[model samples]
Target: MKVGITGASGYVGQFIVRHFLQRGYTVRVLLRNVQKTKIFCAPDGRFEWTCGDMSNDVVLSEFVDGVHAVVHGAYDHLPGRYRGGEGDNLTGFLESNLNRSLALMQLAHGAGVEKFVFISSRAVYASGHLRGNLQEHSAAQPDTFYGAYKAAVEAMVSAWAYQLHWHAVSLRLTGVYGVVNPLARSKWYDIARAVVRGEEYSQGRNATEVHGDDVARAVELLLHEADARGQAVNCSDRLVSNREIAEIIQSISGERGPLPPQAKAVSPAVMDCAYLQRKGFRFGGVGRLRQSLRELVEAVQKEQRSSQ
Candidate 1:
């Protein structure tokens, strides 16, 4: 099987590519800067690299050619840039991204690909907090423009799936952590470092999180699982509290700090992954969270020592 992935050098995209490659699928990645992804430039010929952005028609055309399936992980929203911040031109950003996304969907459908897996976000559930629990059939009320756009794209893909008789899966991801993406903002890393430095720590909200590896695995399962087709499922592992996260970081890094108080007596609705579990997808959950934190801390320490 050949899998074509957009934004293949990104944090999540890289993980998806690695997962597919590990499963023995030939992977092709679209990248704007091939030189930055030397780690994936394997000589074994299992991975192919195409250099271009997602907006290029010629590039998008060649990307889906002869591929069995395509994973659309490419997105342009940067933190604090296009999320309706002050002086942010969110309208322009949305217009551009929506155009690109719709075009890609059409292109992939036209390419005779077997399946298309769209990496969506849990933010699509704008009133998810109001509901005691989030479910697959729950009404979507996206608060932020990011959430709105994701919801919009999901709807578009679903429509195409039915209208065009295409197999499509949208994985609504939660806060994805684990494995260091140097350019990405990882709250887990921030908390771990605070513990390592013995700094005062506090958290504003508690939320669910899933490891990058687990998310990749979910996408892989959706590839062959008939039950996953034409479905939009929440892909999350465990409900994580801020205080619990601090404790886990402290324990794993062996760093003592002024930890925050235990999370308030509140059982918020966790993103429901029961659907995924029933489909025979087992998640690593919080059992491996500490080990992942340890690896992240060790990597940080190694980089620090090398720099010094």
Candidate 2:
């Protein structure tokens, strides 16, 4: 099977690409600048890449051609567009991501792709206090433009699949953390460094998170399951608090510093992946988060030693 992935150079996209490649699937990556992704492109013949902006019709057409599935992970966020939670550059962000998303959906449908997987967000769920349980069928009451845009595209994709007979799966993901390379962003590292330096760390709001590899695994499963068609499955694993994360970082890094105070009792927003579990998908996000953080500390130590 051939899978075409947008945003293949991004943090999440890289994991998805590696996942499919490891599974022995022919992967086609669409990027804005292929030259910038040299590290991601393996010499292995199974990977094909094209460089073009998503707004171009010719690019979209060429990308979808002969691909059995499409994974949409393209999102554009402008600097200072979002402050607090609401966005200020609503129009620019929407035009860049949402419009292109609709266009991609239309193009993928037209090109006879067997399956389309959209990387949606858990923020699509009602966002106020983060107290309620979120399920696959939960009502969408987005609090931010980012969430609103994702929710809108999810609806559009589902409607398109239902009316046009296209197989679609929208995986609503939460915070994703993993470190495959130096470019990988893992918040655990930041906290560990801060603790090691005895610096004051910010105690921010907490949310459910999943590992990036686990998210890619979910995508792999959805691509092959016929029952996943037109389904929006929650991809989050477990709710983790900021204090817990800080403690874990401190323990793993063996650093004793002014860690942030324990977070107050807020209603933890736990996302239900029961629908995905019912389909025989076992989640390893929360279970492996600690191990991943430990590995990250080890990687940092190794990098420091190599540099020295």
lDDT of each: 0.78, 0.80
RMSD of 2: 2.4
TM-score of each: 0.91, 0.91
Name the regions of candidate 2 deviating beyond 4 angstroms.
41-43, 79-87, 305-308
Q: Give a tens-digit lDDT track for model 2, residues 99-218.
A: 989999888888888899999988787666767678788778888778888899999978987888788989998887777554325556666556655677887656678888898999
What TM-score would you give candidate 2 relative to the actual structure?
0.91
Clash numbers, per candidate: 0, 0
Worst 10 residues of 1 by lDDT: 78-87
Question: How good is model 1 by TM-score?
Answer: 0.91
lDDT of 1 at 7: 69
Worst 10 residues of 2 by lDDT: 78-87
